[model samples]
Target: MNTPTRTVPGQFTIVLHSHLPWLANHGRWPVGEEWLYQSWAGSYLRVVAMLRRLAEDGATDQLSLGVTPVLAAQLDDPHCAASMYEWLADWQLRATDAATAPDPTRRELGVREFQSAAAAIADFEMHWRHGASPQIRSLASAGVMEILGGPLAHPFAPLLDPRVRQFSLREGLADARGRWARQPAGIWAPECGFAPGMELDYATNGVEHFMVDGPTLRGDTALGRPVGDTDVVAFGRDLTISYRVWSPKSGYPGHPMYRDFHTYDHLTGLKPARVTGRSVSSADKKPYDPQRADHVIDRHVDDFVDHVRRRLISESERIGRPALVVAAFDTELFGHWWHEGPIWLERVLRRLPEAGVRVGTLATARRDGYVGAPVDLPASSWGSGKDWRVWNGPQVEHLVRLNAEVTETALEAVDKLVDPAGPRHPSGYRGGRSRVADQIVRETLLTVSSDWPFMVSKDTAAHYAVDRAHKHAHATREICDAALRGRAGLAERLAHNWSQADNLFAGLDARRLYTAALPSDTGS
Candidate 1:
């Protein structure tokens, strides 16, 4: 018998986008409250736990994780740091108390559950402690996970001030380095949203690899192709690879054996639904059978692995070169939307290696020479209209103009100040002598976040989102007027104004954020 000829090898990639707004003092819990009991934090903790387990078991080195700067800030927030420690301590206490409780049968179960939970929490803290967030650092260093860096605040990049947007992206990359001690080799681009020409800035900021939607790359869902000769390689997310696990209308979440997302008990505030069925009422959620769910997990994992192997073989033959399958999604979709997601992920991560499929980040792929020739890309977003609808839609049109007008006023205030070496006021903020200039810069940057208009347009907290946008814009105008008039007393008021709104680039050099490439007044 003749030996079979070998075909090109294939690859599979998954990018999980993690983000949540400045929810420090914000209210709402479980999924609300913004900051407290952060779902973003919970997701990170859980995902890290899963990765740690697999790593300890000597699993394969294939997983690319992309966390946005906005989410990273929340996780690394000093306030959040203290809160998480307390939360973990409480979890341990609860488990400990439950283990020794008065009930006989329940107590025995409690001991096991609490003991397991304690070990998890302890491992979590040990691996990802405060400041270092060891999980990100370790994964990046070990090459198991590719750290993705995004904008300063998860802004809809296309609609933001190009200058400020550029600034935000650079600053965000630096921020990621601060945590991981390694400049990110790629970014997830906030929402997998991309606009042509933006890659120029990405290249300028040292981002050699990033990802886009399959359509944007002008490729099918199963293969990733590079974009142009800019040297910044782009990987398109494979919808098949993603949808198999979680589709828009169908997914593992809808499986008969997964926990219900919308049926949590209001009074008890506990998730009481069975993975095998839907909820009847808050108090009457059917019992969940993990054994059945585990069976479901195995089935899905096998199906997913088989899909990858086939797609890989078929694609390798067609392209005449090795191919890559990238699946990207919101990290929250996991544990929050599908309670069994963590388990499913664990099961899948462990199974992929045994199945003979390789898993790795874009950096590894590129380093290994798995790339196609470059091509041009189009402007696009991952929203309803797949355009600028989220930024310029009807619900946010008026506020959008308001933002433009306010930004113009602030930009003008700085431009009109003839001399950069002029005022010597003792009250200059962060060493910038112009009291008004400082506030204008602060408010302008904060208001430019695409989240405001997006939130308003989606009717997802419309009032709050609109209020925040207008409030920041109004403050921008106020500061512009004060600075132009050379008002000295405004310092105290502006200081108080910014206390609740501290941000990463709080003392940024505004002038550096403004370049000749930006819009003159930005007022429409």
Candidate 2:
């Protein structure tokens, strides 16, 4: 008799891409690190709490989390570190404010819940400050989060000049080293944007695999594949599993009972909308219903598990072997954008096991021999039109032009570096000599992040994106010029000046970090 398969026998991987732009020192009180502080204080705290709660209850291990280098740098920054400490304390007050108007019995319960969040945020800050982030390190130690690496500024790697792309990934690797204090084994290729030739760079930096979207697999979403001759595996995100919780239109976040992302009460600067009511007017959104969201979470969790069950059975039948369902998402989708996100994740974690889905991280899947390869892939992006249009859209013409200059300038500087095989030892241009080159490489990568152009195109934070792209590109221009001219002292000066103004990704290599096999396009 054939053995009945009740679970997804192979594995299921969920990759959460965590990234925010380099927002240190660049903009002040309201916008920059302040925004970073909100994610750190609010979202990051919630994530850690959820992980601890799940792991404590024995859900599973090897949760794959890809924290971007730019975000890691801010987390380790003294100013950001200090600021986050204050922000957590501030979160306590907000929680208190949120709890004030509930019913008498519920008010008492709300206070306890609010206080619980307050204490957790405070404890999280304490651990992250004096030493490594408890969440980052503890999760990794438990084999809960198989940490994934990305480019220093989370740039669109394939569009960059090969050397700069190499430099960007290496520096990105270095950024991860500072926080987790360990090299990353996997990466969430920034934005799940995959270009055919980007895998060798991931291999060069010691990342075993990186993630991309489902269609890029040409229909095989559960398998991993090698890029070119490299051993690095590419994991495709399971589209069916991903859309249930947070798709563009239908998601638990859209349930009439969750906090609205669009309208905010400018006076209190809080989201004041009815969690479960139809929109009456923009001005009169109600004050968020916590209980209704809890109910919705259960229904959604059940639906999600049902989806996974059917997928597992169908895929297994097709492949003639056990199959995997890898659900990937942006981490910010959880608590930052979807206020009910953490609850949905908690319920999903709890429900999946009860439903018999063997929850796992990519590392565990790899360890268990669930890996395979299908070499060729078309050039694809996770952006609109599934192409480079997001990064090179009409709204970002200036960014395209600026990137063209930086790419050309940095490439020329790389060629000018002392020959590696020459009689004289090449400095790798270390110390002060590489400082200017470091800034050029650093600034260039930051400028080309698909995020700035992406943010502008989406109109989420358009002006800020334009401003940041120009600011970073300007620095790239100044520093790359000094490096190409062989002005060691001048290059060093520009590097220092930029650092004072924008000291992100501290462990950067000014010299071209990697050899690029891709040429950049100029006129977008």
Candidate 3:
């Protein structure tokens, strides 16, 4: 279909799920702090800049951006801010080194890298020294994007103990508020994982909406649906649109002109090659050219805008109502994985409006009357085959058992510390617990993060994931052991050591794990 000649009968929403595991002092190089810094330099910094540009152009609430609490903690952490500055400066120096290399192609790439690094350093010095929270806060305050919260540590909620799941959700929202200065009304549930009854927890926590996979709605995802009689709305990712940009087989990032994410120049620690071809060896890949990438981006933007226009027009007609098409993806896909992603994103957001395709945040779509009947959703995720296998399959069953044991151990230890007759608050945190309980809870959430199993199953940095899970698990077990045996001094020391090693959530209150109605009950 051509560009619309009449008013469209549908709304389009782009939801970018932003998350990274708690990577502050974890490790570096292939995993840990390096991963965080690369994503920050490549994606977050550029995306935030793009949002600000859009806001300056009078755009408001253009998309839903989910920032997980763990990531927020890292972004706002003072040490990460300082270390990231040093990392960026190091990157610039490496580029300078490459610029003098003997190879002409290497020198050309060095020039591009130098420019990017220089600008990033400038941006970091001006806005990021104080931490990422303020910049993110400003974007939300300006209504430039709808912020979506996820459970603390991005846990796989379906497998979590019921009360622990609720606690994570509650604490995650609290984390977001503490950092962003506002509570998100919606969440991009970690991995878009959902089971039946999760909506009830979301509703109780004041969440207005959350996202699920398209199949969760049984392929009829033209509109948001309330799940199981809750006022909380569940939107599904329209994969037809999302896959056009990212998929395993064919996606925009696979384009020959785009920078090859895998082909790095070790001398400078910079990516110097274009994809060239999927089957081509890295040594044979062509050098990346920014000008060529820009040309491809312009074409892709127009094509994408047209695709959205056509889909909305067709879907609205098929459903016989004003449809809501939500395209959701990982925010890191843009600049981190696909180097030209942020530019393409900026172009798409700008061009969609001019192309007569309406663009707004998920909340705006709902508020402007995009509603549907209640749906009883089955278990689902946006993972492999849209099922739970990636997180809970035979391949990662050991992690499943480990998570269960650690969760039980931590919760039981904390439950023993709660006072039965203390002044009770609605949030279950009124009665305080020992600092050991607080430390164990923090370790518990970190152990349950879905990243471990996912990395294991995908074999993408599997060792790092396993090491991290074991590290947190060991810390929790040691802390629990100390607390159970009445070794208060040892418990305090262990907690302090763990806190120094893997501290992310400073405001996490372990008391929140206790259910208010039944103070003694910790979920079985």
- RMSD of candidates 1 onward, in order: 5.2, 5.4, 3.9
TM-score of each: 0.84, 0.87, 0.95
How many steric overlaps does candidate 2 have?
Answer: 14
C-alpha lDDT of all candidate models, in order = 0.66, 0.71, 0.87
lDDT of 1 by residue, 17-130 (tens): 777766555444432344334364446667877776766666545577887766676677777766667766665565556567675533553454466457656764676556
- Model 2 earns a TM-score of 0.87
Worst 10 residues of 1 by lDDT: 515-524
Off by over 4 Å in 2: 1-8, 28-31, 57-62, 92-117, 131-134, 275-279, 413-433, 480-491, 512-524
Question: Of the candidates shown, which would achieve the greatest lDDT relative to the real structure?
Answer: 3
The C-alpha stretches of model 1 lying farther than 4 A from their native spots are: 1-8, 28-36, 57-61, 86-132, 221-223, 275-284, 414-442, 503-507, 514-524
Clashes per prediction? 7, 14, 0
By lDDT: ranked, best first: 3, 2, 1
Tens-place lDDT per residue, model 2, 71-164, is 7777767877776777666655665665675555334434654665567666665567753354687777766567888877887876777666
- TM-score order, best first, reads 3, 2, 1
